[model samples]
Target: MNWRFNICFISFMFLFLLGLSNVFLGIYFCLNNIIYFLEWEIVTLNSMNIIMTLLFDWMSLIFMGFVLFISSMVILYSHNYMEGDVNLVRFILLVLMFVLSMMLLIISPNMISILLGWDGLGLISYLLVIYYQNFKSYSAGMLTVLSNRLGDVAFLLSIAWMLNYGSWNYVFFINFMGNTMESQIIAFLMIFAAMTKSAQIPFSSWLPAAMAAPTPVSALVHSSTLVTAGVYLMIRFNVLIMSTDLSKYLLLVGGMTMFMSGVGANFEYDLKKIIALSTLSQLGLMMSILSMGLPNLAFFHLLTHALFKALLFMCAGVIIHNMLDCQDIRYMGGLVHQLPLTASFFNTSNLALCGFPFLAGFYSKDLILEMCLVSNLNFVSFLFYFVSTGFTACYTARLIYYTMSGDLNMVSCSSVTDESWFMLKGMMGMLFMAVVGGSMLSWVLFPSPLMVCLPFELKTLALSVSVLGAAIGYSMAHTNYNDSLLSMHNILISFFLGSMWFMPYISTRGVYIYPMKIGTNLLKSFDQGWCEGMGGQGMYEALKNFSKTNQSYQNNFLKIYLTFFVLWIILMLLIF
Candidate 1:
């Protein structure tokens, strides 16, 4: 059997089939009263025990099934995307390892076991982000790893703190005894950890930078698995921390991230970066809703968003591949005529992301909006939610126009054919889900109807934003807004909004400058000067001087030594 047509494709189909079975099983278990719990004792010393506990509920099963489904699709897509790579086998193995880690994370109710999965995700993601072996990949890998390490440290500390409770199993204790101060601290640490993993707010720079990786990896990382892990963690811990100040903080951060990334997408030229930012925005939306005491809704959005977003990235991959590796949307237009199927997928996924009616994003996002309207939220939160919704529509419309609706901009000789059957097959597999995932998840997850009583104004906010955004996006793409660039005032305004309110600076340079200066001082004053002088160089000089003194004394003479010994003996005899 050919290597390209072997383990990778086989694993893809197998996992995909397994995922479908798990989904049915999850629905059955959810409808029934069966909750599967598995555990094994790994180590025990007196009262100190480390046990691996697995919790299989509707949530875990469904989530794991979705993860596997997406992973399998990504692997299938990689068959064509990663062709001719010398390390294709390694890439497939790494992807499988990532899927396994995600499964471990989903099933484990124990913090220690969760760490195994969590660290695996971080490590594998870093490796994947640097798979291209370029300087950009290396930098992105470092940033991604360092950002995720913040979460790792938080998890480790939380585990240490949980040891005081005599067990690492947080699922049980968090439900029963989580009202204590120590538990709150642990909850805070877990929130911090989740934020890093999910690319929330300040820890968000890594998500966009991680687009340096392969597109299949992007589809997997940005859509289904890595980014959603944080949201999943929050959903799991929602009961304990829902009403805490940390949850409120998450609401704030999540909302900000949503708005910032949405705005950033409008300005991004790189096709992949724009899509990546949109993913970030949706993640923010999920995090914000989860922070609002609705983890089920968040999880629902997670699954649905995974479906469409993965499709979106896969569509982007098709375009990029066809365009001879060029990822700039500015250079891409009138592609719909050439690549009809790919364009249809791209447009459908973008519309889904914008929460068009009946699409995968609409069910969850619409409910989230309605829920927010009915909830007792403040003005800022409401504004953030609605405005972010509008921004989402605006940027997605802009994206569609730039990539699918304009005149052809590339060289005339270039030919883009939708001939990659594997790519189309992978995308087609997801197209059905993208169309119906929202409704299916909505029906299954929320068996009872949501009682949302909103006023006319609140009820129509989403529709109004969608229309307005579409209009604005069409106008911007068709017209020439030279005043924004030529005028000093508009230039500053455009710069501010276009640069995502200087988030890149605030997250990178703003964070690095003071620490780097401090590090330089420490290197000069302590590491090289004081610490080295007093530790390594000073000790070496003192030891050398002492050895010289000992050598000189030994060389002085055996005769002198004998005379001193005789004198000492005489003095001893007189004393006696």
Candidate 2:
């Protein structure tokens, strides 16, 4: 099949066109203050109304536009990324299905429909994460799916919890019954669901593990759709989250998530994983902001982060592609000299991630920092906010130093040029967005600029932290990796921080080991030993012994009977 007619090309064309239209429509809807709730009443029984609802407002429409736009680019990237693979068409289909699930999630306001979309995302993400079809992919996919499945269960529970509210369309009930006990329970469950889906503290290990998928899938999943689902869900229920007491939990978890992931990224050597950790940190930021009752700000950050993060992943893909599947940053150096365009895009996205002024990330991140600075946040939370900011810059600088400026760390004869025209084309769209998408989104998201009045020290705190982080990162970049290991304890510290405080262990081995061992013991003591001896085997042995006694009696039946009769006769004669 030719490029134009092939599935990849066709899907990209279709999604890109649809994205443009939706974006325009979203803008129109926003400007005109229009909200459309398209509901199909599937069934009506007494007080029950089963409705398949589609909510088309500025939020959904714009989110849909972003998702579709990013998806199109990712598919285009995959066109070249998966070129020689035999199952290219299948990969394209899977990607389309993944986007479809995201669209479903974005549009639906009804719990039932939301559950369908929610489960679809979880199931399809599993498929996509395991697309490489290896042991590592299998493990990562399982972790990812199981992690998301927690959210699915939470969604189901929330749906069931809302059953008493007589309508699955939560948009209506949220304002009316938001403070009720049932709504609180449902909201807490939704928060739990969001946490799992978003990879909050305990659920975070899966985000890095999910890097087992293809780069295109990573660019799509991590950047725009799957991980962001929780943030979007919370945004929809922002009213409820703000009103309820659950927001405190969110505050703590989001702060911890931000801090831990930032630390983890600094110690990480894997290029994709460092980016994944950054994604985790951003998710934490969104969650915390949402908890602060600034859902709009949280959403603003989400959109901007999506743009640059997608570009970052695409640039990483180009580098990884050129490196012949080597993903370690330590093994890479002087890439800027060999691949200038890719490096430039990489640097742009990295700087944006660091919240460089006028870039996509700066608008949202700076606002978030100012809000935290001005908000009545506790001391620990305030520390977490600024410290994590420093770590963000630290990791970004370290990553840049490692990949762009160090001595050549690759094979002497290996090629490292960005020769893939299609890959560059895929990145071009996002690169444009990464540069200007922030200001445009900030203007659209906040009709009026948020006013922040702060003293000099407080205002410059974020900048100071970032610069200090950069200096440390640069100095550390020049040091040998082995020299940092002063002792075994330091190694442990590095490992713990690098491994997300050993959360992957907690999520995987820590979670399953005890249960598995207990299960095996249960099988041995009951199913194999005592219960078997008393149940099936014991019953068989008793039956065998009983049958042997019966057989012996049958073999001596006439003699035994005659002897008993003679004894009875003799006894009777004596009595007479």
Candidate 3:
């Protein structure tokens, strides 16, 4: 790699250490009340609120730690993964840039700082997605960027609303939100932003499109950072949402998204896309729990999802590399003997993801389900959770079976090996953690009394149900049973895809067709007749006609003088 890559990576590592230190110190500052920001300032104070004060809570610390840990792994994984690629150096630089932005995002003190980091992460992610510059990758990157920008606009508008209403800092915003109807509106707007960022129902298409990125990019961005932005935003504003009427709809949206995406995963053939859709579904479940005032559960799931999902994507990448770029799981089969290590890592991660007993996903997912059962939310919410869990099991099982357990018809025995040591080391570390960390963190996050409130007497009961679901799914996969039984209801699928395609139109026009047409015509006339008639057409025509009208004039004294005179007038007005 180039020196620039080395410098950027080293800088990111240094920044990460600084950020971690801030988190630890911030906790101390909060406990001690060392310093605090009462309001906005023209210049930040020295004894200004301790930087730790910004992210002093358990949620922030947990997320920041995950970001730091995953980013470090991605950087190390990239070192070997991108070894001979031409853009290797630029890729590393962009990765560092991405990590730094995420770190800033996790610890940002005010709306402005959070937004700056948010947009920065989005920008670098776009660049990384398009790094290879293939046609499909470029298209995918463009789509992802456009969708993220839509979310950013909502975030910016919410910030504007918060500031206008006299809440300019995190603490103040939370308190103010608790006092007014404006809080409900703000919560809705924030949820809108999160939905788009997290790829919920109507906004989820971009995620599968994003499979065009490199495997590491997919793992780092989709699995860990980009998609999780929405969840982080929700967690950050949990205090507000928990107290508002808007909290009531969270279960509705989150439940529907989880069910819908889980169903959609069954239709996918690409291994990574299947995992991507599942990630969205799982995140939707976490959002549902958060909506029910279970931020702790959401936070826990986010951690586990990051670990196992990253491992799944990385393993998928290794498989694709071995299979000479084939990503269709149908083309893969019976590689367990040849790729024992890969199979072991992949299976372990998949089992964890399916929420097997004692695995990371089991602990996190069970908490969310338990929250749903006991939450004041209606029975429909519980139904959604139950159905979604089964779907999750089916799709996850299909992923494991299709990739690992079938006949050897398409298996290649050319002695293709697992990825490099760095890659394997990262995957193994995650696998080991996924296997053991769930029970440990559960003990820490949920003490005895809370565990007892869960619906099942034995935690093993939930695990048994998840295992049974997986077994049924595996049987279907092995028997080549058609999954059309689990496909989304045709009418609903049609409506959802149709609505996604026309959302921009629907937003500009009303949803009713006649009104929509009238609105469209009005907009067109305003653009072509009113706005263009004023000077737009003239300016456009002038630019187009300039080459023909005055080859010499375009480069001559008269044109130059005219431009200079206009600039001089504008500058004079500004000066005055």
Candidate 4:
């Protein structure tokens, strides 16, 4: 309570004000179209000026505002969520450190200085992921850390590549040298890094695995902080990435990631994991759209998605908390009856996610989809985009069907209430943002609404897919319909989709199986057979025999001593 009263309360107040001011600054910066880049020379060696640089622009300020505002709400919510935990202070501290790292990253324009925040993020996120102090949390933390380390290596490589240009600040060189071979190489590396952090395909397994963290951290990580870092980086690097051939490949990866994660969520039963997969799906949408050379559109979607998704996670926390920590949707039917307020927030956030007309997700998500339709993408990319959009709606509807409208599945004695003041207050605030954040961001980020000219069919396609997906999702909630689905020949396809193309097997176990088998074989033939025999067991046997022989000799030490005494006397006389 003291920890809550002191650190949580103080941090919540400070961060809220900072976030509000950042929102204002962001709006002003956007209106004025001003970018202020400041550099501080740390040291000089030869011709290279080691410098730390900060970029103050609309994008960074707005992103900071959303990140900080969400983080503050999360911290305030945790006041009630983690009230009984003994390590509440430690949790709050980790969260504060996480926010600080995020701030450093948001402002940093130099690759070298950005690593401080990048590595800090990776380290602190690992600490937070393992915050529950259990084996599952540890294992998930390992996967999360190792996957992120690949991004670290990519960042390091890009940093080294940038060294050839005599400075670490990429902003100076990006616009002019964008089409050059060297810049393309750096863009490739940065794209790789962004993919891992943002949880695009082949690197998406960790997103679901990371659900092992507490809900509050999940709210921050999935919504506005950790997963979005990559998209932010790519947005910064868009000038360079779009000039090269890499954007095409990025488009394919993002589309597939979206389809993959969306299909996976419909198969998931764990409530939190389902939400996590949704986050992954939205991340793919952002990445795919950004890859199309629309960084501004991508940023718009990023901010709008953050608001609703954070509220979505908060509503989930309330449900899970009141249900005595049970996370399975199968155990949580008719929630709207028992916890109407939570259901209201949950359904609203979920609808916003589905891009329900003019809600937070609609303004941005609709624009992105519409922009995609207008672009000359290939049919495969086109299919992936729309199909993924449909699946997004499909999963959203399925979650609502399972949790909000069914018969009560909880125990009779269970007390489900949304009376937690702190948690409710946080949700209320995010709900407001989730409802209006889209229009606000769309207005600020754009001087006027983007006018996309499209045929009636094309313009309405997004809404159409959402409706069709919703119908399919609701049908999925019926057991009889599900059995019919399972009976179909598409069962294997469904299984593959549900298993994330078997990524847990491919990405997680697939990575270690070969090395593990090789290590096992090496242990038998090399360590156990040769090295152990010659180095350990062989030496032990040799030492044991020598000791035994010496012991036998020592048994006769008394007689040998007398013989030595006689021999000594005879030798002494001979020598004299």
The C-alpha RMSD of each candidate to the native structure, in angstroms, is: 5.3, 2.8, 10.8, 5.0
lDDT of 3 by residue, 1-576 (tens): 466457545754764575467546544554455654333345556775423325445555556666666666666666667776876767876877787787667766577778878899789878877887898888778777877888899888888888766655665558555747678777888899888888776677677777887888888886568888889889878988888877768778888888777776766677887888788788888788888887767878988888888888888887887777788888887768667888888888888887776788888887666656666767788768877787778878887788777555455655467647777876776677678767766665665536446534534445666666677778767665345543345656654542344443443333334675888898888876778866789678878787766766666687677987999999999999
What are the per-residue Cα lDDT tens digits for candidate 2 across 125-229? 999898989999999998888788888888888888888977888888797775779878988999999999999989999999999999999999988899999
TM per candidate:
0.91, 0.94, 0.79, 0.90
TM-score of 2: 0.94
lDDT of 4 at 89: 89
User: What lDDT does the true structure give each of the candidates?
Assistant: 0.86, 0.90, 0.73, 0.89
The 10-residue segment of model 2 with minimum total lDDT is: 480-489
Clashing pairs in model 2? none
lDDT against true structure, model 1? 0.86
For candidate 3, list the clashing residue pairs, or say none. 26-52
Query: Can you write out model 1's per-residue Cα lDDT over 114-188, one digit (the tens) per residue?
Result: 899999999999999999999999988988898899999999999999888888877667777546788789889
- Candidate 1 structure, TM-score to reference: 0.91
How many residue pairs clash in all the candidates, one count each? 0, 0, 1, 0
Q: Highest TM-score among the candidates is held by which one? A: 2
Better of 2 and 3 by TM-score: 2
